[model samples]
Target: MKIKLALIVILFGLLTTQAQDKITVAVGTNSTFIETYNKNSWSGNFTLNKAYRLGPTSLKTLKDGVKTSLKWIELNNSYYKTFQKEVCRFKTMEKESFKFHGYVDEFAEEMTMIFYGESDGSFKIEIKPYNSYSIFITFTNLDMLRGFKDLLDGKSANNEIDDIFKK
Candidate 1:
């Protein structure tokens, strides 16, 4: 009985750790963007998450102005850090044009994103594909960017329960 109980506890701990390893971050409240060609837009929260599955991470958004969501542009983990660095560099005006190009095999599409500093000091991400419509995403809150970086770094925002239990 003692050995069984110990094994169960160990298994539970491992499962909890695995569950907490996945990170999800919301961009902001009701933040949405329009596709340039179709002029279709949705009013919903934008989110990014790195799941416990194989392959790359993706940015999620609402689909067709509804509650249903869809993921866009699956990118490899290696590009995330470079993207964060480029955003910082672009903010300082060190680089005139910030761009990232990657091919996502899941969609069989080539994705190109361009970052530009807005006049208000915020930044916009423009997704211009060679064969598809363009997408423009404006970041109004800097905290969302920080949260995204933290998510890519394997940090969880849902630590309040742990903090409460620790205290």
Candidate 2:
């Protein structure tokens, strides 16, 4: 009986660690990266230094607009499409004032760990190919994105993963 109990305990421990190792990216998970810019037809040439951080989240409206796309560019990696599952997370950071900051998401797509701290209403993300043109993703929830960038820039660890569906 003693040997059986010990074996069971060991097996359970191993399973727990294995499950943790297979974590999928989602919101509240932080990330960051750096890319250089080259002039494009969409915007004029200019130098802009900015900081990405996750701060307070607030409400905003989504404006209606249409963009003319002259071309479609394919993402470099398909792994993100295969492994990354995007989902919504509801939370109100204890550190932030009791405002319902809303949902966040963390996922790996196109070789980048994306952390959109909070989605106020709407935003956009454009990932440049390994050796391609530079760009930016504009959004209402700037802090959450900033925090994610911090994670990418080594400002935070990417281990803040929690499995809500998996037991």
Candidate 3:
């Protein structure tokens, strides 16, 4: 009976382990800043210029059978240049003064990038006005994307990475 019980326990353990379908990574944060990915649903479209600045919001106006794309933001090089441009010459500029913690995969462009800032416990996005926008993403979505990447890369299976997935 003990042998049967042990076998059953082992089988259950394997089943449970197999059932874990998620891959994850750890973005360290100090005690002050709770991981925002744990909360909130982020939705919005964004663009990142070569410099990494957040672009301005845009609008459209049509009249007399004519239409125009109104660009509210202009790309700059002097203030926003850290974020590299993948294509078009127009670049974006911004700073990561330890305000965010997460990552994203621009699969459309075939690349993955991470964003992190010091964990000061304050959720202040230190963004400037009318800067070029690059890679718009919310914390949860970005984390999920990273998780998928980790799964495919076998990062989840490695015991060394297990520590990063802790809640």
- Best-fitting candidate, scored by lDDT: 1
Give a tens-digit lDDT track for model 2, residues 1-167. Answer: 01111000000011221111111111222211122222333665433222122222210000001011000001212112222212122122221221233223331112221222212322333322223343233222334334433333333333332122222
The Cα local distance difference test for each model comes to 0.25, 0.22, 0.21
Which ten-residue region of model 3 has the weakest summed lDDT?
A: 4-13
TM-score of each: 0.32, 0.17, 0.17
Question: Candidate 3 overall Cα lDDT vs. reference?
Answer: 0.21
lDDT of 1 by residue, 55-115 (tens): 1222231111011100111131222322311211010000111112122234333334444
lDDT of 2: 0.22
Residue 95 lDDT, candidate 1, scale 0-100: 11
Candidate closest to the true structure, highest TM-score? 1
Which residue ranges in model 1 land beyond 4 Å of their true spot?
1-107, 126-131, 134-138, 161-167
> Per-residue alpha-carbon lDDT of model 3 for 75-109, expressed as tens digits?
22123323322111221222132224212222112
Off by over 4 Å in 3: 1-114, 121-132, 136-146, 154-167
